[model samples]
Target: MEKQTSANKPHIMTIPYPYQGHMNPMLQFSKRLASKGVQITILATNDVKTSKLAHTSSINIEYISYEIEQGDEIPKSVAAGLGYVNHKVLKRVPGIIEKHKASGSPIKVIVYDSLIHGALELAHKLGLRGASLFTQTCAVCSVYYHVQRGSLALPLEGHTVSLPSIPVLEIEDLPSLVQAHDRLYPGLLEVIKKQFVDLEKAEWIFFNVFDKLEEEIAKWLSSQWPIKTIGPSIPSMFLDKRLPDDRDYGLNLFKPDAEACIKWLSAKATGSVVYVSFGSVANLAQNHMDELAWGLLNSNINFLWVVRETEQNKLPGNFKAEASEKGLVVSWCPQLEVLAHKAVGSFMTHCGWNSTLEALSLGMPMLVMPQWADQTTNAKYVVDVWQTGVWVKARDKEIFTREDITNRIKDVMDGAKGEELRVNAIKWKEQAVEAMSEGGSSDKNIDEFISKVISTTT
Candidate 1:
């Protein structure tokens, strides 16, 4: 496709931390803006630019690539990688902005992922408006805001904490990065601390959530910043709420084993299969993997599991052969499609925001096993706020036993409690759909955001 050039139109640049979860929502947001005739330039790493899995068809959205130094040697930890990328991107912004200006579509504003705080400062230096696009929920953002304000203390693992206008949460339910003792904590904490500082400086803060979904929290947050809710940022195919031709989000980092997984799901009874995935980033310990395999096999449930190719060898020996009778394991499966299937009754997930929104949108109850970052908070919301799923708590704050996993899965997929969770899941699904539909909260917010961009740029 040819690049469209229109100097009069508002030109917005988006920079998402280079990951599937961060890229997906930011891409969707760009698509929504492009649909409204805005010129969008999405800055991505060289890896995403070359990967065949990353796809999008918005005519107004252009992708600019930058080389990540130490590309192959970048650490696997999200916190470490985030810091590295933020540093690289901060240096590249001036050059990128100059290239766009040379093309006569000078960037009028920047929409940056919350993790990359340096971008906001750069935007100010360039005389461009900067908006913080939080890919996580408002509750997590609020917690971070409080942390920056010194209203909340971190490393409260053994204590319960309460925040104004939010639910009471144990310190354990907070983002794991706040644990001062973890190896990545110091760097991650510094990133977050800087983020809060930049967030206060940003002109607007956008969340990938709708007002109705988290009304109280959103309202409370809006009181503090110029905030907008323009999301559920899911594929139009799944939600059927966006423009008619808009379908997939088109941001897949992994090739999906779609046909095989769908065929397996087709053979299962409705609400009978337990779908498990820990998302793209989180890694499981070897002992935890063994316990998970045993737990799933011993539970006597039909399951579809997505284990990454790199981690497949960690599974117990002969495990696939024995579990093949009732389970299907693939390197990756089309998650949105799988969750929307009638066969998928409950999900055993890492509670990433994207995964959580997908499950809620499809009315699929969850068995949340959050790993790190915003996941623990998402799990807390799932079990306590929404009542649509059960959380798997680590035994003695260190290990999660196979029995605990089995019991939690059963609790959400079998009895009276399971039925209630299912009903609640369906309720959330309906609410999500309504929020995305025409004239709904998310739709209105997007329209308003586009209007603001156009007005400010003009």
Candidate 2:
């Protein structure tokens, strides 16, 4: 396809932090901008060069090739990737910017993942507009903001904590990074800290959230920063159907077993299946995995579980053979499609921000079992704030017994409380639709962002 760039179109480069969870939201946002007649080119790292973003997608995706050794730990590996970008990819961005200029689509704005704060410096040197796109919820970011300001002391003190615009949070409600700052990965903690450091320098700040979803917190956060909640950053087809063909996210890091999963779901009665996924990155321990497997078996409910290839080994021996009658296990299935399916009664997830938003968008009740990062905060909101799902708590030593899982599944699937959860899920789902529809809160923000970019460019 030919490049659609001109002086009037406001060409922008969207750069994510180069992980699947990070890249997916940026790509969805890029699609939204492209629909609004903005010229969008997504900048990705070498790892994403293999992502199956359709060739027919309206947005253009370009890769920055750089290599670094992967460390044993997630935080150290992420840090190394960021270091490579600082040393290698940053050097090449100027040439790419100049090339776009030569092609008559000069890059006017750099909308980057908040984690890669160096992009703001690069934008300043190039005299281009910079926008920070935050992928997490305002609530989670609020906690981090307080941490950055030292308003919320580290190695947390009490049983419960309170902050402005957020409900009182238990020790477990805070992000794991905050809960165990001294014990957990410091590199990731440092990276999260940098997101808020030079944030005031950016021309725009976009959060992948919707106003009504976090009105109080969004209001409070925006008063301090130029925060715009232009999200539920999901595909239009699931929300408003504004972009008719935007059925999937247009990019997938894991090849989904779409046909098999869909065929299985099609046979189940409506609202009969539990759709389980811990997202692309989270890994469950062997004991936890075994317990979860047996829990699902005991629940006696139809379920579809996405166990990444690497993590499948942790499943109990003969678990697959044993579960074949009531469950469908695949490495990955099209999550959005699965969630939207009539047979999927509820979602059992790690409460990753993207997965949480997707379930909300699709009106699926949740069974949140958060592992780390913002997930803990998200799970808190899921159970208490949103009233959409039941939480499956881990017992002593973080062991999620089969009993805990079975009981929670029953709570979400079989009673008056379950019906109430479904009602709340539908309410939030409608709000999400309104936010993405024409003239809605998130749509209005996108329009404002476009107008600002064009006005500055002209």
Candidate 3:
């Protein structure tokens, strides 16, 4: 066998969009590639603080500086961030590559977030391979692809949508961006549309999903592109346990109230607590917050809800005191740990892809309350297709009410339907493990990716 040296190992640089959700899966994928003996470098804007995660892994994270005066305005900041990445950062990648090459570890490939439009072109310009890492599911990506290709016209004509390999979707079930293009931030809408620009030119396209989860859509999309499903992208401890001490993702934007949550949950009986969160980004309107708070109270079930400090003021007056006996409210909790705990009966979530995958991986059913973006689509699959959970249905002419939330929580906890949801959830959890196990679908795809990089680079 040839001796492996720093110079001979294939180096790959990962550039994720500067968001917690985007950066996490890319970092997990880096860990997977590193386990296979490939050299991994994760590039981020200087504003992102990933040192805690970086110190825990063998992978290297390099931060590049680009000045942007961000403020309370989100859309403005997004526009500025995109500008910094496309123009300022793209211009500097070559120097970074040369610096790495001089250090005896040259970047042979650039694996970038799919939403970044210029990464593939820049990779080809520098004579390196490019792989687009899509953090969304095949179903959501297919919808976006059709929209970009002009097959699904904007200002959609009807109340229903039918697409290849996707279930017939109601107009409201579509992604919020697609449903109301004019209402959302224009900058983000444009960035999402650019996900398919020159997409076919990439050397590889990877989705953070398992094949069986979206079998028909994966089959159709794979035929057109060099697509691979190499995910659930969760830590090893929760899935296949192939990697050592991989219990957490190691990067959390918010510190978790771990001890309090675990101790409280430990006191409860198995399958007795409701876990509620809206993820990191989604900020519910005051009305929605009030509804959710009272709804959990009305469910008459033991619950733990993560309400960010910013959103706590929106809660009804004396809410925490009233529900103190039955509920625990915290800013954040270690999500995977909470999900894996026996006390957690079901998740009341916004159905973000990462959260959905985490719930599925842990055999926890969901009461999906989709807020925006691809969440609506994920909620649909969770309820209609996967049979893993029930949706939080709203009353007529109302978005969602306290009564609706109370009913959904009951359906997932004490109702007969909860049994069916648990059965399906356990089955999906086992399938998730199989996908990451040795010789499994995602594992095989990852091995193939590593081999191709080595063969081409060597």
Candidate 4:
């Protein structure tokens, strides 16, 4: 496990926003690049010293630390309100760049998360090649590129957009925030226009979603920009090491009670339990949670819910009394393993690309409730393109009672329509296996992209 250092090795450095969502993908990319003989340096904000992700020490790459904190006056454009990609993440880059440039090992290229504007600029200022890392689907990334070209940008109001392929689906069939933040659509536009002082300086765009999975969007991305498709990077890296599928602290931040969840699942018959998780970011109001709880109850289905503490909207506590016995609730379970468990019939999800891809890979059908931008799109694909799931719209803040929530859950979980989703879900699962195996589309795309990376000259 010695550092592979030589003049000929490609000296590639990476910086990911300290959140698990950003860090996980960067680690996967670093691992893959290390496996391919690159001399890698992965820079973490000084906060990583306290974060659990810093525990993984790889000899192939050097860990350079940058400190991120509240004191550094950060711009509001990048503020996510919480987590690593906040203002603190951006303020650390100037120091990180200065340290890397002064160090004897000159950085040849930097791959950084798109949310971090300062680091990418500093890398360009140092005459280094820089790439933006996007963990979402390529369609979303292409939309960013389009927005940059002024193809889409309206006054920030309550306007809805009709994407090219989406059908005339109701809001209930889309995955989006109940409050409708239009987060990715608007926030990313601001990042391009205001946050990154140097937009044209980027060398490449790296996506963690593969090409075949996003055929039309990937094609559009490649036509306009130097784009690389290399994902469900998590699964590729998970199976990259000749190891069995399991959970690690790298992805699951909360202490996983996988055994507990799986044991409960084991007690149920096949396709009897519904696995519910709304992803890392999204949070529901207490009234919404009560309705959802009632819905699961009315459906009379065995359900496992990953309840986040943020859903305490003054009503969750009261609703809990009704749902106490009918559901198994844990803060977090090993998501991948739980989804693959024999009894997991369907998933209730936020439709984040990572979660959507994982559910798709596991052959689990979905009941999509999206909280942000691409999730809405992902939800549409789940129900429309794939024909393997149902999507729920965010209900009005006051009128959405428990009875309504219970009925929707019953529709997707216990009714005749739910059966159709299951049949198609199993079919998509077969395609996912084909895509992951040797000569599979995912494998082939990675090979093609890696070949381009190897053949390209600085």
lDDT of 4 by residue, 316-413 (tens): 55555676666788777888778878888889888888788778767788887776656766777787777877755443443455565566677766
Q: Give Cα-based local distance difference scores for all models.
A: 0.81, 0.87, 0.87, 0.63
TM-score of 3: 0.95
Which run of 10 residues does model 2 get worst, by summed lDDT?
A: 67-76
Candidate 2 or 4, higher TM-score? 2
After superposition on all C-alphas, the RMSD of every candidate to the true structure, in Å, is 3.3, 2.9, 2.5, 4.8
Off-target runs (Cα >4 Å) in candidate 1 are 1-8, 50-80, 155-158, 181-184, 393-397
TM-scores for all predictions: 0.91, 0.95, 0.95, 0.79
Model 3 scores worst on lDDT over the 10 consecutive residues at 68-77
lDDT of 1 by residue, 68-185 (tens): 4564566666567777687777877788789889977788898999888678889999988899898989898888778877787655545777887889887777877764434665
Give the runs in model 3 whose Cα sits over 4 Å from its true position: 1-7, 45-51, 65-81, 395-397
Pairs that collide in candidate 2 are: none
Per-residue C-alpha lDDT of model 3 across residues 1-458, encoded as one tens digit per residue: 12236656789999887677887899889888887778888887664464467575578878776564365223255655675566655876888899998987789999999877798999999899999999999999999888888998988888899999889999888898898864666666667878888888999999999988899999999887989999999999999997876888887878899999999999999999999998999999988889899999998999999999998889899999999999999999999999999999999999999999999888999998888999999999999999898878751345788998899899889989999999999999999999999999999998888878888888
